[model samples]
Target: MSLFCHRIEVKSVQTAGIIIEYNPMHDGHLYLLEQVRAQLGADTAFVGVMSGNFVQRGDFALLRKHARARAAVESGVDLVLELPLPWAVASAERFARGGVEILSATGVVTHLAFGSECGDAAALERLAEALHCEAFPALLRRELERGDSFPAARQRALAQLTSPKDAALLSDPNNILGVEYCKALLQKKSAIRPLTVRRAGTPYHGTDLVGAQPSATLLRTLLRSGERDRALALMPPVVRRVYEAEEAAGRAPVFRENAERAMLARLRSMTEADFARLDEGREGLYRRLYETSRSACSIEALLDETKTRRYARTRLSRMVLWAYLGLEPAAFPRQVPYLRVLAANGRGRELLGRMRKCAGLPILTKPADVRELPPVAGELFRQEVRATDLYTLAYPDLFAAAGGTEWREGPVILP
Candidate 1:
């Protein structure tokens, strides 16, 4: 019954890792955590590898990572690990790969769980296998040549090579990422088994709050619209409390538009060659950015000017973020170099003790440790620092906008 390369010993307690952004922890996230915990038994250790200040959607977190991680720990997760900025703001393939790699490095984790629309592990694995088939690459290239976006082309190729049902899974955001998680597990030859819980309530992009478990999108909409009470109602009490505390401290509710001026300034300063080196920058897209930045006065304007059928808004947004951060395509490492602890509870501290013995990579716990990393890792950490500095500028309070928080702040420890 084991899907992993190594069989779990009967006497050992199981540990499961979840990959999440928790951009703002809501009831839906709590549901997934509770469901997975129930399935694995109360004794199972729950670990989460979460995105940092930036998230996969090419936006800053509604709240900082420390606040979000604290909420996750209070809700049910024992430990939270930081997924570095490069991968945090990457495409789905790289995002899932980075998350799975970090979870696998922990060694004690035997299973990887995610929320998916289909929640069928077997079907997801089949789709993952199809992606690796020898024919997939040629078909994908054909779709790309036809001017389809990468996601659109990949879905079309999967539909043609496999079935419409399998391809349709990609339409559901969670299912698409779930498939990538399985693919990463296989690619890494990881010993962790993959699992999925059914996503409740609306689709990932649904904007209206409708049930006990609402989409994060809907929650964000409510919060941004000044419907704080309504948004709080859709989250656990502890999560709500953390969100309130962070807001009181002037560090919550950061939006992409907060950095509108800085973003425009950075783009205006960059040349076509500079944009060409950003992730997803290619085929003269850099030239488009260069031309557009001259007249585009707002982030919305820049996006409208540069976006095309070939370049999705999310992809363009990620590219813009990379350009703003001065990150080149070669900046990221081929593989993740370290496991960083962002937040942990008492149980999490115990798990860290275990990781020290079995972790394949270094487990970083302090800002000073950045000095000890190899050249590549040090550069990656510097990118994170720079990103954090820029992120603080988005804080509602000017005093909170002062940089260097990355060095001053420590992991959130929940009692």
Candidate 2:
């Protein structure tokens, strides 16, 4: 049978893998989860590989990762595993790869489900295949040389190699990520089949709060602006409760600006060599960042000075964020080392039973469990510990921002 046919004809219980940041779980996110169950089966388990303290967008998550994971579990996900610091803040390609690797390592996940504008897995796969063609690289280089940003250049190259309709998929944020998911799955030769649900309500980056499904960007804006009720209205009831409880504890609505001075202090103290060490592009981007840091008083100013047509603002922001975290570009592992459980429901417990027997990577449900794993994995977990400590500094209340919470907190278990 064809792979597409085989993907949907799975005989065993389906466990759908979702890659998420869920900066805040809103109705749109809930709709995607429900859609997965609707299309796959009501009993289908959801295993989410979520970005931890930081997100792909190069900012602190609107809420702590554990709280967000709790919201996810309460909303319907069976298990939520962390995507880890390195991969969490990396480029889209690496972020997708890390999440995909985690789910593939689980061994129990039957499919990868995500929201996309196109919502056509086969189309994304075709685009993925086209990207892998030998001719695509030369075309990409041509576009890059024309002074386009990496994302813009890649889209331009794809447009050149494929029909406008196929290349147009890259224009939408969700479809771009969907294509990356397909590419990662193909590159790894993973057994997990790919699936997509058409995103409902608001567009990916939409800032308007008019629709049934407002974007997470809008929600974050509302939360940071002290509009709690407005933000809560967009989230699921369970998620709203979770945020309310977190806010009561002085832990909700963590923003990057809250910790700006600390990040600025860290960046200002770094040497040119240090910046160079963290440069991924090897194209003098970090050098520009270093020069900009000497005069730029705020993060926004630094980003503005460093950003150019060739370097997207988000790319520069990731660099600055990584610099503050002391994470060098070369330090990121190509594959996620371990599955760190962040939150789980009762169904997640059963899923864990199956994972113990079949998971390709080590699973860490407790902080102490790292001692039994390889040193590499242990060190990686330690980085996450440090990252959490820094993340807490962004909390509204410094009393709740104490270090060592990473080592103290285990998975959020729900009844």
Candidate 3:
């Protein structure tokens, strides 16, 4: 059968995989979960989630990772697994690969469902096919020579082969992330099929969603505004209740400029070799970093100074994240060594039981549970600590109340 036919056939699966980062569990996420559960019956869908010190958006999880996971379980997620630092922040390709790989690794997920404007699963598959075309390599090389970053180079190259306006296809963060999901599923060649859910609410980052709810961006914006009650208004009752409890316990969420600055300062101190070591280091990227580091006062500022058509802001941000963690692309763990249980309720717990018997990876339930970390695992954990330290620094009051920890090896799970 054609690749299109194969993907279409996957809609009839039992369990589905959702790759998400619910910065603050909001109504939009609830809507997505409802759709997933409706599409595939209960207990059948598996949710492989990412929760760490930082999010893909290059910020702290509004609520802690464990809290976010619990929210997922409360919402109806069956399983929630942690996304490692490399996959968590590397790039769209790595994130998708990591997410798909984790869900696929569980050995229970049969369908990979996600929100997208592209609508048609077959079209995304076609896009995926085009992305891997034999001619793309040469075309990409030409674009790169024109001083475009890898992402920009690929987009421009694809546009040349396809439509002139097609460069916009991979521009949005959502679409870029979507394409990566398709690419990851294809690269792994796993039985778990890929599906894209037509977005029903607002755009990925759109702030307004009148009757129903606002996007996570909107919610974060409100929460960051110090209007905790108003910010809590954007989420579901369960989420608001949870946030309320955390708030009552003295955990008022705040954007951590200090955390970001600490990380940025570390980035500024790095030499060119350090930049090259943390992936995205090729051609003149090292040179760009060496030059940009001289005047960078913050992570966002450094990105603004160095960003160009050749080096997208997001790409630079990911590279900076890797640098903070000391994660070199050359040293990434070849295979997933373990699945850290971040959060799960009864259903999530049930899925975990199934994963135990079927999962190919070791499941980590405790923070100290690193008996068998693949090569980069230790360093990856260290990066997470750095991120948390940054997070704590940003919320000194919160951190101070919560022991103001340096880093703990074991499960720092909430609830």
Please tell me which predicted candidate would have the highest TM-score against the true structure.
Answer: 2
Superposed Cα deviation of residue 241, candidate 2 (Å): 0.9
Alpha-carbon error at 40 in model 2, in Å? Answer: 1.1
Tens digits of per-residue lDDT for model 1 on 114-155? 999999987788788789779999999999998878789999
Q: Model 3: which ten-residue window has the lowest total lDDT?
A: 406-415
Best-fitting candidate, measured by lDDT?
2
Ranking by TM-score: 2, 1, 3
Question: lDDT by residue for model 2 over 364-404, one digit each (tens)?
Answer: 99899998988888889899888899999999999988899
Candidate 2 backbone collisions, by pair: none
Judging by lDDT, tell me the better candidate of 2 and 3: 2
Better of 1 and 3 by TM-score: 1
User: How close to the true structure is residue 354 of candidate 2, measured as C-alpha lDDT?
Assistant: 90
**Tens-digit lDDT track of model 3 for 1-415:** 3343344343454777888887777777777677777767653655756756567754556776666776677666766788876667666777788888888888778888887765566656656777877898899888878865677788888786656554566766666777778877877877777767666665677776665767788788777666667777768887887777666655547464546766767777888777777644555676786678778777767778887765667667666666665667777766666787776656666677888899988787866666356655665666666666555555536435343242453433332
lDDT minimum window of 10 residues, candidate 1: 1-10
**TM-score against truth, every candidate:** 0.95, 0.96, 0.86
Residue pairs in clash, model 1: none
